[model samples]
Target: MARAGSVAPRQRASAAPESGQRPGRRLLPRSRILLVLALVAALGAAGFGAWALYGSQWLRIEKVSVAWESGSRRELTADQVLSEAAVPLGAPMASLDKDAIEDRLLAALPRLKSVRVVRAWPHGVGLKVTEREPSAQVPAPGGFAEVDEEGVRFAEIAEPLPSVPLLEPDMADAPSVRRFDEERTLREAVAVAAALPEPLAERTSVIRIASYDAITLELSDDRTVRWGSPEDSSAKAGALTILMKAAPDARHFDVSVPSAPAASGG
Candidate 1:
């Protein structure tokens, strides 16, 4: 029976879920379906574009051109690099292996320091090469070998370069030779030669390397320059320039310590 002051408890609200979604579940929005369709269409278009780039004849490679860096002075020819490259012709530009071509050319030509293979739009591939510069001429069995800045004996030349100094190294005594590597004394000699100024370099005949610390330069006039080691070469060179002018009649110059240079034996 109902109480006098209070009506029966209000009937509990319906326990069932709303018409839109069940409890703890969600409905997929119509906007989301459209977004998903658009994303899939964009992905399909990208895939088709990639396929066309990979297989189309209109984008194929028709010509391969080789270029040398200006004033390289290397014996290599563009034809030689191109022949060694064996570029994949008639293939799509986007699918060609440029690195492989560059590696091939470098392997075939020791004088080549670096190489680049570029895709010229439409139908051409361009190859550019930078060759190593000879820093010194080291004596070999029958001829001289050109050494680069990194002490690499890159090429053999019949005659030594007049501008570059010749190196006379006794690698048999170097500890590195026993270790199955190039002698450090030889590199020290090359460093000494590569640092000489133009006047000294042109008149320089041969560099004698007794060891890393005993490097001597024999000039064309038979004058000697005692260069102790490869360190402080720039400072030593500058000091030598001043010492030569200060003592024009001196025949021997020692600038191992630029701070205390000496000249004697006129």
Candidate 2:
């Protein structure tokens, strides 16, 4: 023990920290918290989407609409298209077989060149259609069958179209018909008619197919063009234009060999 006068150096207070000092406030990692939040958001979005796509009546097809594409002329009315499409009412918009609907419309209507089936959001199914335009007229059993530029016979008319030319394939003992078939010959004639220059095409009254290589064009004025085969049609057209300009009075033109054209019978 030390002497009385001086207190033995007051016991130094322990400076050591207390044991188990709350380990850095155990906290959730920032990344873990963000991941949990993302999962919750994703679950919520998926639930909402499912409800909208299937469970909700609001997203069902309540109305159907039909429209022409590109202001195409209507051979069949909207009612006719709707009847043929027969899209199931009350079906979920997301559950619709759009391709099937399009196929149905095309199969049922020959006048349609193409069709687009659209989901008009919220509660509608829409149909957009393009109608085939007559490229030529063919004499059929009942009436003249209207053929498009692709040579598809789509519809029939009682009266002939004045603006369009008549396609006359020589089905009577033609050698080309025996070899290439009548359908092929008709297509070839259609190609020649389609390739005719603008005013000339408009003025053409008949496209006569005698043989595969013996296609001819008769203008409204009774002038004739020996167009020969569908091959080199562009060259033939060019030659015909030049020949017409050179000898406007000629009644018959032969442009089978575009390099050497001929005109006669003025």
Candidate 3:
């Protein structure tokens, strides 16, 4: 009955999928496996990093050393600072309390102006120190106490340094005590000493303070400068410089009034 010239239609192939495998099931399992491997690797790296930073001996402090600014007077020895620091040896460097160490050092050593705690990587701690320099000397029991520019009496020395001047603040009178207390008087005298010119400061011998307005400076070679109070100190210093240059032979110089400086009695 079929036409002899036309071929019969070809039949289509029908294949069933394998068991437990959907259209994208094979790709999903492979993606999940890669994600789990990545997560495990990240966790392992974090654990190792934590152990290396804190729990490992390689990052722990083994040796401690102290270093100070060069050309500064070494008022405190390395042993003194170390003893006060009391840094825990064999502790992890990353776990050290830098601020605590600095606080202890400053509290124990009054001569230290500043302290910088540094981790000298791998196995050491370094303490960098800046010491207070003596601006003047105040008479204290058993010896002289060195005062810095801020009027802080830091150290006691048997003999004062030659370049440093002596401060004798006698704020015992009722009027002076009422106007300015002993502490303020001391601070004012220190301020005056600090404001002096370098050349005059080196030549100065003593700073005597009876009242706030009665601050006097006794210089070498029988010279004297009548510096009033701490007020107008900058102006006073400038006036004194010019007066001294103008009257080199004069023995008495008064710069209490910077506008009208006086000089007499060579």
Candidate 4:
């Protein structure tokens, strides 16, 4: 011990980094936790944006294309009819009502026999229409009513075709003309026309369905074809061809029974 001012040699301080770093070790875990939270938040935000853009009602029918079958291939543009039909643009594709649209279209175009509606994904609707085909014309009280293959009376025409056959009563005791049976008589008439020989068919101008069992055909040459039933029509037609060739000058020929060879008038 010296006098009042005494100085002990200072011990050499340790210069190597501290063997253990508590603050840095603690900070590493806290930084990792913050990084994980940030990543999770970013992923959640991305998912939400995707849902709003792709899964919303912004991707709906923007146009329609109407197509017709038979005759002219007229296509009605979407822009012309969509507004009048009241179809909402950008509406959900799942909410589209096809039946309602079909009804509206049919009402607008009465000439259409049937209509089909389809959805072309994303921005379009498709409509396919079938129009009525006029097969025959019959005289009505006011005018001539047009009939289809089904014999359904549709519309009236102002003018009459002179070449068409005039349906008349066969005998004085014949029953009055009844309502045309659309399904049976009309369909049978179409079948008969289709089955007639080209030469005989073109010459035929009038078809009279007297009853379910009796069908009489009046040809352009003022001859008569007594067809008893719709059965064996093709065979009867073939027989007529053979008979007509044999007796060209004959005023009338009856080939009703194709199986039995018979002839009248030379």
Candidate 5:
């Protein structure tokens, strides 16, 4: 209520800051949020690395066991094989070469027909081996040799071979020795052995394999069996069984031809 140009003293405002408004709030920019996220990610990675290096149990292979049906159990130990194989104990399971291990085992033990490796989780390995059993003994240059049905020579017998039937060749041209390089003759012998009758097969001492056309047998009694061809060998074997039963004292029985069999009496 003074002059028209005069100012009011009560209208002058105070100089204090506003309530709930921080002065340094503007310094926290978007880059600070990104920095915090990166720090959290680095800590998580470090924790995962620690677990993989020291805490995880999946990195170790604890046990190794082996089992076989034939041969000495102490001959093929899983620990020895695995040690020779050079596989790491704490290595990852996915990095193992199972097939390579099997091949190595086969190379180490030639008597095994097949070998299988099983990997158990967290820390175990199992090995199973299948061994070839000798079924027949054939006359060789040195002495009697043990062979499987495939005619593969495995061991040599000094004397008094097992009482199994001997297989002899009817013709001189037939191969008596089993060559390790050739598999054809061995496979054929296995086929022939499978075809022989159980009773006659048990008595057979040697199996003489010639060309596919001329197959023959030599009995344990120092007699000859003229087996003409491999075809219908089972039938021929059956016929031989009947003839041998009928004339047990016969010296030689020719069952090569089932339709017309010839026999020689003692």
Candidate 6:
């Protein structure tokens, strides 16, 4: 069987070392492939669950409940708040924007000092609101404007609050009032009121401000307390309390300088 020209063509092998997989086509181990598939399936399931919770009707909003945290008077009624909130009635609870709802409520009702809008699980949205309280009253166009503890004029009331004293600021004649700050006087007066002890504040009938430096309080009995400026208010308040108890008969008490306090008679 001596070969002729081809010499048996070098006896081609049937299962020669197959060229090791192509450059960009390496095959993964079977177990590794199975793990990859499991991971993909888990992600897909999570995605579907999210879609159902955020886009389906099973968890849609069925009710919006408004609750008051503080027992104070409500400037915005429950019905009014509901009407203003306009919470998407049929939207999925998970899709509802809690921050947007809170912003909307606050925008519609400035009387709401603080508000919390949250998903009350299953199918409801809950709102907890605290109404602004009137700390003092100032003369408005036709009635009186109520100022909250933060020195914000929140409402105009036809009748003055009996318990809350009136705040009078003499700014009409003082062009210099605008030189320092537009609301400096009113803010200072509110600070003074806030510094006073609750019992003393309740007894006070009026707070007068001639400037940021001149803050005075008139008691229910027509007695007076001269509280100058907002600086050292805590010290002034403490001094006033002790002075009042020490000289209950004094008609006028000056605590502008709490360290060297003074008391005078009519």
Q: Which candidate is the best by lDDT?
A: 3
TM-score, cand. 4: 0.56
Query: For model 2, what is the error of residue 147's alpha carbon versus the real structure, in angstroms, after optimal superposition?
Result: 1.4
TM-score of each candidate structure, all chains considered together: 0.79, 0.80, 0.85, 0.56, 0.57, 0.81
Clashing pairs in 3: none
For residues 54-168, could you state the per-residue lDDT of candidate 2 as single tens digits?
9988799999999998769877899999999999999899999999999998899999999999999989888999999776788998789998879898998888888688999
**How many residue pairs clash per model?**
0, 0, 0, 0, 10, 0
* 86-121: candidate 5 lDDT, tens digit per residue: 555776554567898888867765555677887876
TM-score of 3: 0.85
The model with the greatest TM-score is: 3
RMSD of each: 4.5, 6.7, 6.2, 12.8, 11.1, 5.3
Better of 2 and 5 by TM-score: 2
Clashes of 5: 10
User: After best superposition, candidate 4 residue 166: deviation in angstroms?
Assistant: 6.6
Of 4 and 6, the candidate ranking higher by TM-score? 6
Q: Candidate 1: list runs displaced more than 4 Å.
A: 1-40, 170-182
lDDT per residue for candidate 4 within 1-266, as digits (tens), equals: 64577777688986666767543445588899999999999999998666644566565678877676557323344454454456666776667888898888677654557778888886788777776655556667877766555655556678754544333323223342254343455456656655676677667778777654466778888777776556778898888878778877776666667776355664
Greater-TM-score candidate between 1 and 4: 1
Residues forming the 10-long window of minimal summed lDDT in candidate 5: 174-183
Q: Candidate 2 regions off by >4 Å?
A: 1-41
Q: Show the lowest summed lDDT stretch of 10 residues, model 3.
A: 21-30
What tens digits encode model 6's per-residue C-alpha lDDT throughout 77-126? 89988887889998888778888888998887778888888888798899
Q: After superposition, how far is residue 173 of candidate 4 from its true place, in Å?
A: 3.3
lDDT against the true structure, each candidate: 0.83, 0.88, 0.89, 0.65, 0.66, 0.84
